[model samples]
Target chain A: MKKRTLISVPVIAALVAGVLFAQDITTWIKKTAGDKPALAVPDFRGAGDAQPLMAVFNATLYQDLSNSGLFEMKPKSTYPLNNPQQQGDIRPQDGKGLALADWASPPVNATHLVFGFATITNGVFAVYGNVDDTRQQTVQAAQLLSNRYLGSPVEADAIRKAHEFANDIIVKFGGSASLLDSHIYFTSSRGGAGGFGTEIWVMDWDGNNQKQLTHLGAQLAHLAISPDGSRLAFTSWPLAGGQPQIGMVNAETGRKIPFYNQQASLNSAATFTPDGMKLFYSSSASGTPQIYTSALDGQGFTRITSTRGNPTEPKVNPKNPNALLFVDGNPKEQIYRMNSEGSGMERVTNGEGEASNPAWHPDGQHFAYAWTRGYQAGEFNVFVADIAEPQKYEQLTHDGRNENPVWAPDGRYLAYMHTPLKSRNAQIYTMRADGKEIKPLTTQGINRYPVWGVK
Target chain B: MTSEFFRNRNLTLTATLLVAALFSGACGKKAPIPPPPAAPTATNTTPSSTNNTGTPGRPTATLTVAPARIERGGSVTLTWMTTNANDVSIDKGIGTVGSSGSQTLRPTDTITYTLTANGTNGSATATATVTIISPPPPVTPAVTRPNPMGTLESRLASDLKDAFFDYDSVNIRDDAHTVLVGNAAALRQIFMDFPNATVNVEGHCDERGSAEYNLGLGDRRASAARDVLVQLGVPEAKMKTISYGKERPQCTEATEACYQQNRRAHVSAGQ
Candidate 1:
């Protein structure tokens, strides 16, 4: 028998290079995929008379994705689709056609698409959606789910799951993800036990994992966390018929200590300075939520701001100690900023709309705030603007009512509370800084006051 | 040949018998058996029990060392022993005990005491009997008490009813000095009964100034009061001073009426 030895150097090198190239391609795909322009949903056909269940489903899905931080969704408009007449003029054959020109127009960048269909079949509400790749001309994903819409509380659970389904599709289509892991601290009054009994509660940003933080049945509000996330400050109404006081609690230890005591109102939006040496808050101890500064040791308290209208929600700029932003009134509250020593007070937003609950982005150059436009008629939305150029404001949401905007650590996403009148329930939502690809992040109870964790 | 052969056979027989005897001895030897102990007798009492003699059948008596009471700030020695105790310990209240088993304690006030003892059987305890004979109260000197400064004098008069002071000066004013002189005489009489009493002079301020500044002002008021007593022949060591700067208000209003009632100084006695 003859033994033969064979060697092929070029073949081995070619194989090795192919493997390396494949890995590089995969990495590039993941990176560039995130940079792709987010798909826009221009219209909800036949949505003018959308049943209550369809509104609930669409609102929940929008809120869940917006809170997820995965996609940059355009704010949903409540106006009946601008061209409802055009929908009826199209023939059956036209329904199957791609309205490419319409989809590619302003405010409708056709990178990806989502369309929903809801019908009442056999006394049950059936809802489904088709997520399309307008660029690829194909249906990328589809979902068909039904709920009995029984006029009970259980319907909220079904709606929540449907919202989750929509969020999963967004994730699959390479969009920014939802904030299902985040929790919010809000006040609630569900059990009908009387009084201004505001209890602090925490639930998944997607409206699950609901838990109560306070059970004293006191009117607790104005919750803020320290920059280090080690403590929480809030004001509690009178307990045991005693004076109201400003209170602080160790977030980890749950140990509560009162910082201010007064016979009159004594609580406001109390936040810690970056160094945690001083606290900035509003108090009505002297009447009205006037901004006050005090040492963390509860000494050297000085009123920094005094105005005819109450100054509330003082959020310190992360990059600048001498700067602060807050809302100044009700009936027509407006956003304002001032120096730490109360000098250089200037109005940031015009009095066109009632803007409140201002939150500064971590970058210190931008802020997100809830503006109540046509509030009397129940039309409100959130807006974001760059503080460096306050005149350049961007409207971020147009759903029934969106408020309480909080910025994530990366400044790449925002979480806010959205309430749809159809469901009469509030949920959390997230969207990109550009106000595109908005989606729901929570689906249970009335979730509000979302605070992003320091990363 | 016959003789040699017989000798050889005898040698072999002797060797075999010796081998058998050695093997048997090896197999027969066993561990030694212990000797039985002698029974206990009533005369062999434990050394601890023999030495202990407080009360037969009663555990050794323990003495508890009470905390020391200082006489004019001098130390006091305390000692305790248990009868028939193998080990005795004195619960030395505030002071450390010496190797000689005695402790010298210097305390601000009279204290109780306790001690513990242990024997072969168990432990016991005892408490020291305490008789608190309080010292006589210190004499208040005949000097006039200092008047509160600024708004303090009038505030003290209104709040305390019995106390008063002059304006802008801590010196005891003539009119207020007369009142203090009378109180001093009564205090002197009381001191004769209790010679070792001490007094604490507390000063306060109105809410017209910063806290730190008011604290210093209050201290001055208290010190002035103390100096008057000292000059009047009261021992300096018998008086101490404290200041409360605008912290405790007599009235809760921001009006002058409330401010006037908030400033004052008073003396309290301790024995």
Candidate 2:
């Protein structure tokens, strides 16, 4: 009887502990799954294809997932995937008919999957996609989208919708739904405002909310955002006689204040320090665009770099507060890293391609910059390189003239301005950090000089 | 032994029941206690007064005037008045008007206009406008501008163009001194041929310095050149200097050729 009583007590305690552990596990699972997953969709379709309509649907879906920032997106492969005659057609109709057993393995491990279809009916293009829950073996959601074809059959609008669809899929799956709502501030010269006059403009990350920040008459360039995203530092030359002055304007208040006023021609590519207490700029005030530093209050001016050649575009490393990365000009235009006081200059890349506009990742371990093979017209593209091992540089964009790569705060993606060789206008494009999943973040106007907001 | 066992079991049961009851009671009564009421307070009993005079509830009899805006050479009249006027006197812009209740005054150039009105309830002050028209333009000094040196003066021009100064320094070096000596000799001959002509020395710098510093450096370079000419027997007042700094560059490229052309001093003549 004594033995039985002792054993009964132990059994009761074990039962209570088991119940508590089960509850804890349930809570952990709920907490882990509470936030939406991030999705990355780099590129939807190329410029021209036989199935242009379907290409648009794929592009839109990819952009939608990317903008949603939920679900890790696989890099898009441009193989023969959509043709009906192909062995594996992943369009919605066929995707809906797929059996659970068919997708239980390798590439289809994703519990939720999206399939897109495009068709030109009576010369009017329409695209649609379906998201399926493979575990449930059911079509979770379907969207039918239409795109306008205004004479030109380039199908930019169709591709844009496909990007939107991917974002909608993540939203429907209970992900953080505000991913597509963010805006990108960039420089644009659309509307025949000729003579290298680029105005600051903002647009939705997925290319919808287009608005100009500066007046059409102002000559704006070299835009930088404060680490807090409360103010913007840029170079603006007034229409009247004066040098290009460094101007700081409240991002929300639109109150402009001059950061540096000098009579010499000042073309300042200004950037805020990580602590937001100082700014680094390249100015001819010292007789060339050598790097200079000043307090945020615009005092305590100091010449940080005295290199023989022009040193412009100073990008402070986000991870290491004491280090700075900048473009050392002439002959090579290669990216260099140095201390904040401009000592211990080290060359980071030795590629034949001239690299400029070095933008540091939030971690500062890696950076994205623009590279061109000399003065070739259509050879510019964005590349990423690890600072620790400077020799390892990876190309990010393969399209025409992509330059000025700025990283998103999360270090997962980059926003860059690209000017296609065929089109005179420049637009903003975004891609994953691994040089995959490229997509246009802006469609209207000539957008350039993109600076991602601090996270 | 049986009695002791019964007693121990009864005590253990009672203690367990007591703890369970306490926990239940605490959990069931989890609501916060209500706060105590605040005490009532008294209100003010004073009556309010009204008037345009200096009564407690009335606004003061102060006159206000907008600030005046006038062009550099233009003039404007300012006027002010008070309803209960005893004695009016203009405090500022006195020559234009002295009476305060109501007055019109005009002045050339910018002037501050103030007026005071004395009343039974004390004197009230009002400000008036004083407009001054355009000020005199900056005086254009009588400086000599030299004619463009011909091809015969190529060696002098080349020597002058190659003379680069140290950062921010304008003191003529031995090389620059020798070059300027030759140039001054050539300039003297040119001035003799054109007796009524005056020479203007323009100074410039390379593109590597700050704008203001460059401007000052250019000025110093021109001053150095002017002193050389004066020492060479040209009249001290005949040689005028202007510094263009890095602006108005002869070449806009970043190459050595362009930079060499940028750092120089030139002589221009005016007939």
Give the winner by TM-score: 2
User: List-wise, what DockQ does each model earn?
Assistant: 0.00, 0.01
Candidate 1 chain B lowest-lDDT run of ten: B38-47
User: For model 2, how does the per-residue alpha-carbon lDDT over B157-267 read when each residue is reduced to its tens digit?
Assistant: 443333455544566778777767776776666666555666667778764443323444565577677787778766756565655566446776556676667777776
Chain B fold agreement for model 2, TM-score: 0.39
> What is the Cα root-mean-square deviation between model 1 and the actual structure?
31.4
Q: What TM value does model 1 have?
A: 0.39
| Cα RMSD for candidates in order | 31.4, 38.4
Q: Which ten residues in a row are the worst by lDDT in model 1 chain A?
A: A1-10
lDDT of 1 by residue, A333-430 (tens): 57877777776666778777567678887756668887765553224577776665556566767763777778755465677767676764556676
| lDDT at A170, model 2 | 46
How much of the real interface does each model capture, measured as fnat? 0.00, 0.00
Candidate 1 per-residue C-alpha lDDT over B1-271 given as tens digits, one digit per residue, 9 for 90 to 100: 9999879757754653443344335556542222222221011111122212233322334232333333456554454434334655555443332212545555455555655556556555555533345567999879965553313323323323223443223456665555556545544544554466665565566644322223334555666665665666666676556544343445545465665555555665532
Leading candidate by lDDT: 2
| Regions of candidate 2 where Cα sits further than 4 Å from its true position | A1-63, A66-110, A113-181, A191-196, A351-353, A374-378, A434-437, A441-445, B1-271
